[model samples]
Every structure is written in C-alpha cells, then in structure tokens.
Target: MKQAFLTALVCSTICSLGAPLKVKGLRTESATNPIGVSNSPRLSWQLDSEERGNFQRAYEILAATTQEKLDEEKADLWATKKQQGAAKLLVSWQGKPLKKGQKVHWKVRVWDKQDRPSGWSKIATFVVGEQAKLLKPGRISGFESSSEKLNQLYRQSIANLEKRLDAFTEGDVAALGDGSAVHRSARAFLYHFDSVPHLTEWLRLMDSEITKDNFFPIYPGAQTTAPVSSDSGVLVTHPLWWMSGDAQPTRSRWDAYEGHIIAREAQDTLLKGTKWGGIADSENVAAEFIDLCYLGFSCRLILELALPAVQPQKAIRFQVYASRIRKSFERQFVNKDGSLKSKSQTGHVLALRSAVLNPEQKAKVLADLIALVTKNGSKVGPIGAHFLPGVLSLTGNQDLALKSLTSLNAEEQKNYTESGIAEWLMTFVAGIDTIAPGFNQVIISPRIPSNDSLSWVRAYHDSPTGQISVYWKKLSPDSALKAEVMIPTGALSRVILPIRKNQKITESGNEIADAKGVEIIERKDGKVSLITQSGKYSFLIK
Candidate 1:
C-alpha cells in the first residue's frame, strides 16, 4: 500500500508542468543518416509535453499535405516510453506500394490520456531514389551501384580460382638459369593471390623446367621433403612430391610480411638437399613455411569468393593439408609413447590442425592445440604452423575460436602486453585477423619456411566485362575455339577467351574456354552465343 501510494504521488508530481507542448524532431532530415529508398526507412523526432497529466501518458500520429481539417481519419498511434533506439522520439511506418523516385510528405500528432489533442507537427518530406539515374529504373536508395560493382569483381576473381587448377606438370615449363632464386622463387610460389599476372608468369617460368619425372615423386603419398642443394637442376627427382624450396620475395603490401612465410617454406624444401627436414637458415625456413602457408591462403580465398558463407572447404583441402603435416610430425616431433618429445607443442599442433574442420577430427586436433597451450607457456609462436586448423577452429563452429581468442599470443592479442608471437619462432603461430599482417622480415631468425612460387592451380574468367585472369600460362596457342557471344552496346566486346585450337569442350576440362566467368553471349537472329577472342596459349617464358 505504501509503495502504491508513492507511485501515485510520483505520477501526480509528473503532471504539474507549465510549458506548452512542443514538437521538435523532424524525421526526414537528409543532413544526417541519409534516407534510403529501400524497404527499411529510418525515422526520428523529439516531442516535449506542453502541460502535465495525472500520468506521463499517450500520443498519436498523422501524415498528410495540409495540417488543417482531415476528412478521412487515419489510424491513431501511441508511445509510452520516454526514449527509444536512436532519437529522443522516433517512430517509423513502412511505405506501402511505394512508387519509384516518388517524393512524399508526413507529420505526427499527439494526445494525452485525458483525450485532448496536442496539435499536429511540422511537415517533413522525403524523396525516393531516382530510377533512371541509378543502374535500374526504380527506387533504390539502399544499394550503392559502385560498391555493388566492386563486390561483383571480388566475386568474379574468386570464381576463376576454383573451377580451374593453376598447376602445370613440371615437364611443360623451362628452366630459369642463374640460381639466384629470384625468378625461380616466383615461379614456384603459388596461392589464391597468384591470380594476378605477376604470380602466374613466375609459376609458368618454374613450371616449364618441371618435367613429370622431376616434379611428382609419388603423387598423393609423396613426401614434402626436398633435397637441399642437389646435383641435377631438373633431373629425375621426386615424382609424387610437390617441390617447395627456394622461397620468393614479398610481392605486395600486405604480402610483404605474410609473403615472407611463403618464401621461408618454399625456400627450405626446394633449395637443394634435405637437411634438418630441409629447413636450414632464415631464408631456407621461409620456403618450408610457404608450402604450408599457400594451402591456407588458397583455401581462404576460394571459400571467401565462391561460397562466402559455406566455409571450411566442406572437408576437401583440409584433409590434404593434414596428411602432409602428419608426415612432418612423424618425421621430427613424435615420440615413441605417442606424446610430444619437445616443448614446442605448437609445432605438433600445427602439424595436426588441418583435421579440425571435421567434427571427428576436431577431438584430435583440439587435443594437440590445447596440449600446446597447456604444456607450453601459452605462447603462440608455434601456433602459426597450424594456421589453417586455427582458422577452421574459429570458423568450424568451434566455441573456442570465438571464445576471447585465447590462442593469440602477445603479438596477436593487442590488449595483452606480450601478445605477438615471433614469426621465426621454433613453433609457428596462427594468423588471427583474416589477413595476417607482418614485418619487413628478410627471412631472419627463421624457424620454418613460409613461401612458395608454384603453389596454386586455378582457372578464371569474367563475363559481360570480357576479362580473364589466371596463375599460369597453361593455355597453348594451338588451342583456339569459337565462343558465341552477346555484347552490351557501349561495353567493350570480344574477350581473350583461352581455348584449345579447334578443341571442343570435351571431357577433361575447358581446353581454352574460361573456367570461371560467364561467356559473353551473341544474340544473333534472336539466338544467344558467346563473344570471344583467340587466346595466345603459348609462352616463351625462359
């Protein structure tokens, strides 16, 4: 009874205001939060009470050209809350059957519990997006035409990487002499980013020198090991194994540091001979690390492009990466009792992390990752090796990935004093941010190789835009085919469509046709066909 009386007293006190009610907020302010011409609309306002009521009470709203007499009474609305989401007073109404580029006006009205109207509000007007001015002929303030085009390009770049494999049998490429590892390094490093011509040119140069007998040592079961500084340049080498030695230089801005990783890995394995698992010094270790790094880079790019949402490769590349990591683990780190022989638990974790994408594989991968954290000082330097697994952990529905990012060391966790993990640590650390940012490292203090020259195999194309991008020049000049096409009147026509000369789209894959982008069509006689250009398939890359 006492509480109720207090509430009544408070309510009574709230009704004794003397100022006249004032309507201050106008929702259609284009000055801020530019109004959008889409399904969702933003509204805002400020309403002050002119007089007090027995209770801090009710309100109504109306919209029309004239604030004067209203013949057709519209629905009355009310608001009890003192404040809400953004503005002091904000309410929104969906524009029904909204016309394109149409401009409309509106206003709000209010009333108290005693049933007295507080007068109508000032007029506010809004204009929808002009159709002819936009890409489409309709109201569309929500979409940015420029941003949409960029999004399309990003999508197209990824599509090209997937449907096609950028790899060429070593036998096809020629040897780049001078042993400086500059051109050779570029030729061998491969990843999703290699879609750029610079990377493909390098891959083709390296690929030419790779004969079938020298490239693959044993196909699937092949070892990741490379002979450190061997006798023959391109003789009968490992047939099944993918050679990753002689790491390359950092190519791009973001790639400078991250690219070091690829360079370190590929340099280590493909240098010359196998010594300490082929990872020798800073430069050499960079090569070994790149071999592992490229796999993650490619997987991330492919997933980001084609299936923006469906990640973790749906269990394809992860398995392949795991097998190689396992081979390395057994070679150097494993103990007789199935326990770690060294304190670098991260190394072991990195070796086994690829399997985490699989629910069944997570248990094993998690055990290794956690063991590294538990047994070690929670340092993430070694964690980098299993970067792909860590990404999978964060993305593969694993609670741990999103759970405060505990795995990030001093360098990784900015809030922490010692968050960063060294790039050349005995055990590599995982990349947390989508794109791994690093230093201008010259492969110094290297723990493992991290770069690759010929690491990716892909195909690409763009439609309506008449463009194509690839990692290697695998297309042959002898291969050229006709592509029916359709060209947008003002747009540039005829794209350099790579095709096997007189080659039909038979079984194996597109001989010369683009693997990704849409074929610009030809609407001749009301029939649609693709417009194309003869691609220069052969290269004298030396």
Candidate 2:
C-alpha cells in the first residue's frame, strides 16, 4: 500500500564522459520483487543520464537468496544472460526455489546504445512475505493465497477513481483531463471485473458527463459544448488521446484535421457514398482511421460485457452499432493480405484486438501482425505497445507474447502498459485466469511453449471463493512437465494441463483416476482437461 522510491546504484567509470553509469530508482512493485507473494517477482531499473536520447540496449541481472552468495560474484539463485531489449523494468525472475519469507538480493548491469558496459549495480534487497499476509493476514500456502492480494489491487484502483469522480466536471471532460476520457477508470472496472460495487450509479454519472457530442474540455465552465468547433467528435474524448501528445498538433488540431479527412473522403468508395465525418487525426490517414475504429472497438467490448447484465434491451442496439462500425473498419483498414493499410503496429494489433477481423481472417492477421513487429525490429509506439501481449495470447501465441512483453527498454514507463504485461505473466503464461469475475470459476491452462525461455512458474490469484495457486515446471525436453494446483473451497476450475505428443498424464504416481468433484473431461491434442472442485492436485505429464 505504501510506495517507495527506487534506489539507484553508481556503476564503474566506463563512459567516455568519465562518469560512472548510474542505475537508479529500483523500487519493486507487485510485478517486480513483490514484498510477499508466491510467484517469482520481476526486476526493473532506470539509468540516470544527462545525454540526450540515451537508452539501454541490453541488460543482465543476478539474484541470490543471501548477501554472501551475491558478494561472492555467484548467482546461487539465478543469472540472466545478457538480454537484448530496451525494457529495463519488470524483468521476470528465473531462479532457484524462492520460499516464503526468504529475502532476495539482486543486482544488474546494462549495455548502453554505444556498446559500453556498465559495472554491476549495488546490491539491493527485498523482504519476501506471503500474499495472504498482505490480503488475509494469515499464514497460508503459496500462490493461491495471493489471489485475494491481486484482487485487492483492482479494488484499490477502483476506489481511488471513485473518490475522484466528482472532480471530472463538464469542463474537465472537454479538456480530456488526466489524458483520458473521464470515464476511463469506470470503463476499466467494467471491462476487467464482473461488476463494480455501484455499477448503476457509476454508469449514470459517466453518461451524464459524456454528452452526445463527446467533446472533452479542460474546463467545461458553464457551456455545454467545447469551445472548439462543433466538428469535434469522439476524438475529442478518446481515452488514449494523451498517447499522441508528441504529435505536433494538440488534441483540438488533430480532431479538426480528422474531421477534414472524413469530410473530404465522404464520397470515396471506402466511405460508402456517405459523409461520415468527425474523428481524430494522426501521422497518416490509416492511423487516423484506426483511431476511429478503436472507438467502435471500445464500445463493442464494453457493450458486449455490460449489456446482458444491466441493459438487455439495449444489447441489439449496441451490437448493431458496433457491427456497422466494425465492418467499415475492416473494409477500410484491413487489406486483402491481412495487413493494415497503415502498416502501423497499433493499427494491425487493434485490428485483431478490437475484433475487427473475422475468425477466418485471424490467422493471416496474426501472421502479419507478428511480421510487422519483427520487421520493424520489435519496436511499437506507445498506443499499440500495451495491447501486444494480450493480442498475442488471445491468438494462441503465448510464447511469442511472453517474448514480446519482456522485450523492453528504459523508455517505457506507462502504468497501464506495465500492468497489462504483468497480468499476462501472472495469469495466462503462468496458467491462471478467472473465468468468472471475482474468480469464482477459474481456467488453469498453462501454455509453457516448447521454446519457452522460462523453466518454471509459481503464481496465485485470490478469488472471491478462495485462493487459487499453480506451480508448474518444464525442466527439459525429455522430462515431464509437472504441475501442482491448489483450489480453494467452494470454487470450481477447468484444469487444462499441457502434454507432449504421445505422452500421458499421471497423478500421485498413478494414472489420474476420477474422484468425486474430479472428472476427466478429455485428453487429446497434447492436452488433458479436467473438471476439478476444491482441492489440491499434483500431476505429471510424460
């Protein structure tokens, strides 16, 4: 709950300027070396620099269970070979068994853009505590106890925004206060969780603040409309407007330019002989078009989740609207080869993420998306970067997703981006996601790919029902993939464990025999699925 500043360490004097390259600001959070958690914590560091555009090209980290091991220049726990990427923060930990309450000592060194190597960072330490200690205040088993801890994070995030709801006045809406649409926090809660505590009230307030014109002003004052031209549309209030802060024109300028693009192309075939005007502008027409498409995508995701529970009748209306926009988006943006007209990373990723592509088009689009990133040397701008991991996982490319998410540089500091990547590590790649909001029912399906850089994972999610934990290991190609799961009381889980071809699964050194609340669903295509209820399970796939 309390935040601490990251500690910086001075490196050996190796730079041309004769100053030591300082690795500064190393505060570990939930994703990094968590104070008390089941899963392995990640590590991140920042370089203190005065040079213009200085950045890290690669880095290596070493960790030990004790200071003695670390001082001996040995990685008793783990040592990362130099990893090539700009990402210096939230690097996943791959080390020996880290038990609860064991202190971790670690240090890092980096290679700069000029190919100069920095000296090892000063040793830093973090006390390990149980997630249950933080959440339930009791001694409990591993990752399962951490689920409540993770859930509390979401709750806290929502509570923080709930207190600020009143500050978003009509003027704040027009100005796009805090770089997002006023309803961003509310929408985030709606999208991720099953429901919020005060759903109806939250929606009502959001609706009242965002008017039909969708223009967000810094200060609404007494005027109902933004001072800018009426041509402004949803672009004026897009949540991601701040991402393009580097764009030469301000929000108003981009909105006006987008309006011009729509009006000018109203008669084009892509425009369908209709004048659909008003949107956000970007570096290119395709980027601008994708921005509009993203708006429709956001609406679709929201309505898809919110409608059935709250507004049943409005379902058809929202679906129709979302469908029409999606079709326009696909027709205009998605090319025949499954590439975006813009060929931009964000455009392609959104095409997949926003559900603009049909099921049949997903494969091609995915391939193109991967190529786009690889072709560009794995560098994506801010807006599209955050979506990459989820997009990859949803497309059955967990291996690639993990690779992409960890591939980072010092430049990335976005809160949402970091958290999204962390979620992937904790849930999908680590093999745990709540099928039900509040994690009443979970799907424990670990996707430890053959080429995975990680050897093992231990993670937990505290659910409404109880704590769910999973510890998995794929020691080697010849060895069986082992898994241990702890299911909470009153909760049910669909466990889909991975297996090699021609391999069978065993539990307790024997074939997995069905028991009460444990039914073998099926075993085919290198996977075994089981319907499990409320118990601890250990299995080996060989």
Candidate 3:
C-alpha cells in the first residue's frame, strides 16, 4: 500500500509540474496593438513556462474582426491551424485582406516540446492604415550589391527601422531628444519606399504640440523652454507635403508656424551666434553640426518657397536672414585653406550638405572629407552619422562610402539610424531618386565605383505611382557596362548612363535614340541622359 501511494504521489507531481506554457507579450508588426498597421501585418508573441528545457515546438493563431468571433474560434479573418514550427515572430498575416481603419483582433496558442498545448493568449488588435497597401511581404525597398556585407547591412537597417516604428507614442517618436529630427531626416527615404502614413501621423501629433506662442518644443511633451531648431517644422512639413501631395495638413501647420518664423527672422533670433556661427544646440559638436545644418537647410527651403508667387516677400526676407547665417558660418568655421576649423566628420558633412561652402570651398571640403573618413571610418555620433554616407556618395567617393559603411561593427551599426543607411543605398548605390514630389518624375543615375571593389547592384522601390526598379552590372573587368531599368506606369524617368572614351551606347541592338519610350535629353560630361516613359529598357555601353 505504501509503495502504491508513493507511486501515485510521484505521478501527480509530474503531471502538475508539466503544465502548459503561458503566452504573453502579443505583438503585431513589432508593436503592441499598433494603429496604422500594415494590411498584411506580422504577428508575434512570447512564451512563459516554469519547467526546464521548455521550448515551443508549434503555434496556432486565430484572427478575426471581432472578439466574439475569435473567442468562438471562428477565425473570420485568418487561422493558422497547428503550424509546425518554432517561429513565433513576424508570422505573416495570411487571412483576408485587411481594410483601412479596420480593427483586427488576433490571439495565439503554442505547444511545448512534449506536445502539451497552452491556453489562447489575450486577443490583441491593430488598426490598418491607409498606406498599408504599400508594404509588401519582405522589404519595402529591394537591395543587393556586389558586397555581401553591404547587402546584409541594407537588410538589417530596414529591419531596424521597421522595429523603431514601434516606439511611436501619442506625441513623440521614440520620445528621445532628437525624435523630431529623426522624423524629419527619415521623411525622404520613407517616401522612397512608399511608407508615409506613420510619418503623417507623427506630423499630426507634432502639429498639435505647437502652442499659441508659435513655439514648438525641442523635445515634444518634455518640460523644457528650449525652442526647436529653425528648420524642424518646415523640414518635416514641406517634404511630407511633397511626398503625400496632401496640402491641407501641411498648409494649415505652415500657416500657423509662419508668423513665428518671420518674427524670429526679423529679430535675427533664429539662431544664436557663438564661436561657431548660429549654433542651434550648444550641447556638443554633433548637436552643433545638426543645428547649423538645419539653419542652412531652412534657408534653402525658404528660397525654394520664394520661387513661387505666394508670399514672395516673406520668403525673400527669410532668404536674406538665411544669407546672414551663411556668412556667419563661413566666417567662423571655414579656414584660410578651406579646411574646417574643427576636424569633426559631422561638421564637414553638414557643411557640404547645407550649401554653406562656395564651389572652391566645396572642392577643398570634399578632399578633406575623404581624408577624414579614410582615417576615422565613420566615427560620427548618431546625428552626424545620418548624413555621412549620402554626402560621401554625392561627392563622387562611393568607394570610400562603401568602405565606411561596410566597416561598421555590429554595435556601431546599431548606433546609426536606419534612415541614413537606407537612403544612401537607394539614392546613391542603386541611384533611384525623385526629381519631383510623389515620384511623378525620377532620376536613375546609378553610381558605380571606378574600381573593382563593387561590380553589380540591383534595387527597386515601390513609389506612389508604381514600382521603380534598376539593375546595373559591369560586363567585364575593364570593359562595357550594362543597365536595366523599369519605369512604372504614369511616371517618367531620366536614365543617365556613364560613357567612357571610345564607347558607343545602344539599346536592344539599336541606338538609344531609336528605342521606344526613350528620348535623349542631353549628352554631356561623359554621360548620356535619356528621358523614358513607363516601360522596361536595357542599355549597353561598349
């Protein structure tokens, strides 16, 4: 009897200890109940257990438009019935197509290694966004390059940015000091991939934070008296307006902030003069570089705004204020030999990008920048790092840019924002850029390195109109170059092909001039520029 009782107690204890795993931390698209989720959202959840060696062997997910349906296991939306895999993250939504503004309720259950099933997790929900249709299964922008390291970096950067989107709050992005700046800097790249609804939502939140004093906080929702950088508001609003072609939201905010900007300009208080002219943030050299860049960028934007007849005088006056800041910058920062007084990489990059340097100064600055990057290898802080790769490519040092980019260690790469890396790869490496807002017109000028370090590249971006793709490769070690381009319907592209001495260009066995949907715009400076309508075209330069 005693032996039997002992045996029964052991059996009961074993059964009790082997309870099912509990599910928690349910997420969709790396967010907890996110608003504006993608149509085909990625689902994820965490597993909890007390037993040692407990591991998930399989999972089941049920999604519905209503909680009642999900509770009844109706799965009116999607049901992954007994999926056999260890994958618990980013499981693609395979149910019905999610509509805009529709709330999707989803829950999950997992089986342990011993095949014991867990209870269904609490149902989580995510609302579909208007632009959710733009997101595809994998990456928004397709990228592959000669260097596998760069290709991996491209993928990792895109993933990081998607994850960062989860940090969006009611009033701030990531709730960091430079959250607005990140949003502003990321606008163009996001638009390149046709990802804009989240940015639009962020802009709306920022607009609401603008007080009657016309003061936008440097850190939204933070207790601080410091004013935002001069260009923050316009930088975010103007590009969003151009990309989305939605005028009302941008126009209304512009109208509200215009008076404050003008008042500051009139008072010459847009920035404060320090050893470095008009340092917007006195925190560090990185912050100072960012501030100066913003001032210069804001000036350029005002000049662009002045080109139109609407409020020309105000725009002109702003330009004048901008000129004063430019002169101050040049006087304080540029040395006699055109070298920067400070040997900071961020400062050099921003100086070139902000249009503060004259042609001669720019040439000298470019040389200096190359030398600096070669020595340090992208040692800038978060803010400065954003502009480094793009600037390096723009100055015809793609080799150096690639070197700096691929040389980043895992931790160093993590420190850099996804926007900078993605923008550089898409805009410079693949060379697909917008000549007009909303990608109505594009420029396909792939910059191949003169050296053998990089041999081929292929990339595509889904624009608002349609998908624009480009692929280019060298036919031989020192021979001809071949390029393939895809222009979407209702869009125009300017395809620029580099020409070497004694090389002839042809399209599909004929001269490029005779190709359909192709119009030669100009042949200058060793490049033949052709305007192409929506179609695929292959070119050979030999």
Q: Which candidate has the top score in TM-score?
A: 3
Model 3 residue 359 distance off true place after TM-score fit, in angstroms: 2.9
lDDT for model 1, please.
0.30
Stretches off by above 4 angstroms in model 2 are: 1-208, 212-287, 413-419, 514-516
lDDT of 2 by residue, 326-387 (tens): 67766766677665667666666756766566776677877877886555534555446446
Error of 1 at 123 (Å): 47
Could you tell me which 10 consecutive residues in candidate 3 have the lowest summed lDDT? Answer: 130-139
Candidate 1 local Cα displacement, residue 203, angstroms: 1.7
Candidate number of the best lDDT:
3
> What tens digits encode model 1's per-residue C-alpha lDDT throughout 504-533?
441124432443323434333322323322
Q: How would the candidate models be sorted by lDDT, starting from the highest?
A: 3, 2, 1
Stretches of candidate 1 exceeding 4 Å from the true structure? 1-196, 209-278, 281-338, 353-365, 374-378, 382-399, 402-542
Q: Ten consecutive residues with minimal summed lDDT in candidate 2? A: 239-248
